[model samples]
Target: MIGAAWRRTLNDDRSYHAINLNEFSFTVPIYAYQVEGEGGLSLIWSRPNRD
Candidate 1:
């Protein structure tokens, strides 16, 4: 699904020039913190790997 979206973006009509993203990988920052909830403080952390 991600690959299909990437292909669509590359072929989008809004883009005038070609876009080539080869051998690329993207990583979002892992945040670890706490949030105050109605039941007091709650834990917040990075999402575990899904695959």
Candidate 2:
């Protein structure tokens, strides 16, 4: 999900969001709709343990 869920939250057209997930210490940098484009999501950073 991106850009305020594209549904409108708190009646605000624009809002700031951050993604922080800790399992593999995964985190994503701030991204806007302009970057997401049609995909609606951008992978800024990722870590995977294939082993």
Candidate 3:
């Protein structure tokens, strides 16, 4: 099984400030022979427009 999740952070203006993420999680049967690897994970941020 494979899955992903996400989280969001708010700024002082009560707007979206940044997005946090978790890498995909996988589950495999014991008999299945497989090699697993991971890549760089990152967070994206944006500034809120205050009018």
Candidate 4:
């Protein structure tokens, strides 16, 4: 499981904030999507335990 937070500032003195959460198995591929006029998203994965 993973969590994230986001914030954006516009040139007109406007701002926006958002939050997201993600869950996936260690053996599966992850995917993400962003809608038009919405903010962006970032995905990060860590290597599984080797032991």
Cα lDDT computed for each candidate against the true fold: 0.37, 0.39, 0.30, 0.47
Misplaced by over 4 Å in model 3 are: 1-39
Please give the range of 10 consecutive residues that has the lowest summed lDDT in model 2: 1-10
Q: Please, what are the lDDT tens digits per residue for candidate 2 over residues 1-51?
A: 332323323354553234434433334333333224366755454444545
Which prediction has the highest TM-score against the true structure? Answer: 4
lDDT of 3 by residue, 1-51 (tens): 332333333454332223322233412211111222254343343333433
Q: Quote the positional error of residue 32 for candidate 2 in Å.
A: 12
| Reference-based TM-score of each model | 0.29, 0.21, 0.22, 0.34
Ranking by TM-score: 4, 1, 3, 2
* Number of the candidate with higher TM-score, 2 or 4: 4
Our tally of clashes for model 1 stands at 0
lDDT of 1 at 3: 21
Model 1: how far is 30 from its true place, Å? 5.1
Model 4 regions lying over 4 Å from their true place: 25-51
- Report the number of clashing residue pairs per model: 0, 0, 0, 0
